[model samples]
Target: MSAPETTTTTALMPMVIGEHRIAVEALSVLEILGPQQWVAIPNTPPMLPGALAWRGRAVGVLDLGPALDLPTLSAPSTRNRNAILQLTDDTVALSVDRVLEVCRAAADAIAPVHAASWVVDGGLPCRGEIELDELVVPILDLDAWAVASRRAR
Candidate 1:
């Protein structure tokens, strides 16, 4: 007779864009929201898609898929949703199909990625411990992204 061993599972926050999958640490996310009509910001870069009035505060919404120039989602309802995140001192929102789950993977599970166009942290082009499709999605540097948007003006 043998005894069974126990296995532990960690929670990971999941977001979807079409068939692709994106998962991050649940603690990294602040809130998950449903579809909301975002007012598009004109003359802004393709990355800075729009802004929404949240609790009397105007927060910029980033189109993660589009900002990376990835395929667009098919459904209009899916396109209208947003994922709110508190990165650094900024409270920015990301438009995603659905906020799936808050599941977890081991820290060693994530591997590094290489690409100049994709920026992960302030360090050289490398993917983080998060798995986001086959392509590397840059970790949002809210301060830098906001600063770049300002410079674009």
Candidate 2:
């Protein structure tokens, strides 16, 4: 077979989590939510920061910061957005700093990660750029995270 092409016509919808940036397939995002009141839950992991009341249901929130065991880039007073995943079976919201404009990139542009991160062990893809915003960001694997969360419980 001949060599494959280098570019693809697709783009990605990425969000800034704390200071790190990541992309979830545009189709995977249910909606982008603004800041809201967070209620703490007892005996939960640090990543499970709290829960939010939404549409008559309580949605658990996950903070990518502790989820990856990475310190907040700048004490997150400005990073205050949440990306709700299109969960086919559970309820959880990913607390990010903000959502940026969708950008175009090839599948090969997603660099691999080699270092350590709690999230990586949990379900973060071993691939994706880490040094986004000068900080190591573990691009999350939503499907894997869901699976791990269930296993953790």
Candidate 3:
């Protein structure tokens, strides 16, 4: 016989990117850093705004706007914000407009995502969703987004 085991729940960390609010897996977020030095790289795709030095390494940053086909922030600055997103063995830095406060909710609190049912501002496909106080926020599918971005280039 085996004793019943209960699963522990952790809150979701949603970040505000441009006009969209997306939450990646909380643990996947390495750190949220204030704007750092960004240097433009010639011949890079629009999705890659620039690269920055972090922890003695050059981490190329991606701008979700163009990559996701979403509306970009009207006025982005060097002082914007960055969310270091890590998945599997891959990691990358994201330049977000701002990050919202951490929200407490079970993963079930979010609605299931569908390939056809989920759609963002630019008709982008989403994987999951959460109903925030004012609006429904979608969870960005980083893996899928990465695949699409590579195809776009």
TM-score of each: 0.64, 0.70, 0.73
Output the better candidate (1/2) by lDDT. Answer: 2
- The digit string of per-residue lDDT tens for model 2 on 1-153 reads 999866753355677764456666666677778876767777876677568877788887876676445663232231367777765677677777778776565666556765435546644643454343455544556776767777888
User: What stretches of model 3 exceed 4 Å from their correct place?
Assistant: 1-10, 67-79, 113-125, 151-153
Q: 1-153, model 3: which lDDT tens digit per residue?
A: 898976555566777765667776676788889976677777776666667777888776767776456654222344378888875545678777787777776656667764324345444456678777767777767777667666887
Query: How accurate locally is residue 5 in candidate 3, as Cα lDDT from 0 to 100?
Result: 70
**Backbone clashes under 3 angstroms, per model:** 7, 1, 0
Error of 1 at 4 (Å): 19
Ranking by TM-score: 3, 2, 1
Better of 2 and 3 by lDDT: 3
Residue pairs clashing, model 2: 111-128
Task: Give per-residue lDDT, candidate 2, residue 115.
Answer: 47
Q: Give lDDT: candidate 3, residue 102.
A: 73
Predicted model with the maximum TM-score: 3
List model 1 lDDT by residue over 74-123, tens digit each.
32233645777775667777777777756565655555544323434232
**Model 1: ten consecutive residues of lowest lDDT:** 118-127
Ranking by lDDT: 3, 2, 1
